[model samples]
Target: MTHTAALALASGLGFGLSLIIAIGAQNAFLLRQGLLREHVLPVVAVCSVSDVILIAAGVGGLGSLLDAAPWLVDVMRIGGAVFLLVYAALAARRALRPSAMAAEEARSGTSLWPVVTTAMALTWLNPHVYLDTLVLLGSVAATHGDDRWWFGAGAMTGSIVWFTALGYGARLLRPVFARPVAWRVLDALIAVVMVAIAATLLHGL
Candidate 1:
């Protein structure tokens, strides 16, 4: 790659990682799925791939359409809020009734579809994601001129690296999460955060 392209890629990687490396519904859900060590690959794939699409769309100028439509953002906001509230309830229940990963896998009856669905919902349903990936990232990428794609590629790399680390690396914490109390704590935190995020979304609407 050229020196300019390298810089653009590095900038994109940094920007992408900064935006996603925070506490949010998507990360929370992914973390939970990772801890369970169930469908980790698929979950990671969904998040990483979705991010790539969003970043690509953003860099490709889809941001203009998304920007032009206020109703679209509102629709996403409402849907995201509703989904978050429901997810919060589920997290709360899990906190109240904690169980080991083994038992959860055995009796949970949670097939791949639901897990994938939740991952998609947690990702695409979130309004911030659209704005961040499409508008914000797109605008920033535009500053790179012809090298903007390099920036987007860098950002996509960041997403893949982050999701992979988060999903696969979660197994490293298995010892800590082995205790039911640890799960209860994690789930409780997730519930509280999800509710707070949902409330923020509603208030913004």
Candidate 2:
């Protein structure tokens, strides 16, 4: 393969690996709703749409500016770490809370608009998201000479496919999550994932 093609492939893989496996607030929320059997399609729809917008923004040279302004990236890193930590704490609290109350809160009608808004915020507000998709992924793509667009395309494709599978796939596990204990376990797992990611981010600083 040519240099540009190689870069495109590597960049696409890196972007996919970074994002595809990480279970974030979006995934947790989707899983929760899937378990409850509520608004699954709409929830996934909003999430996938938000991700496409953010991923496109990242690949379109927005992430490149951060390289010149290292401090800005640092600020984002810190801010994202703090946000993740706060989310982790909240998840932990929910895990410890009584199941009946938690179920009620989860079942309560949450406006689809708010969920979309929240998904957008989660995908876009974090500096790390831009850094990962725009800066890091874009930088790699730039190395590929002219075919960099393909790299971005592949990466974006990965994001769309992954989220769609995750949001919808959660439904397949409905039978398993029927137990109250299963919900607690899922909440605890989400908290752990968030805290672990936050710790990794902080350690880099």
Scored by CA lDDT, what does every candidate get?
A: 0.91, 0.69
The segments of candidate 1 whose C-alpha lies over 4 angstroms from its true place after superposition are 99-110
CA error at residue 88 for candidate 1, angstroms: 0.3
Across residues 1-205, which tens digit of lDDT does each residue of candidate 1 receive? 9999999999999999999999999899889888888898999999999999999999999999976898888899999999999989987887886554345556544689889998999999999899899999999999999999999999999999999999989899999987878988998999999999889888888
Q: What is the alpha-carbon lDDT for the whole of candidate 1? A: 0.91
* Model 2, position 179: C-alpha lDDT score: 81
Task: Supply candidate 1's per-residue lDDT for 37.
Answer: 88
What TM-score, over all chains together, does every model reach?
0.95, 0.78
Clashing pairs in 1: none
RMSD of 1: 1.8
Q: How high a TM-score does candidate 1 get? A: 0.95
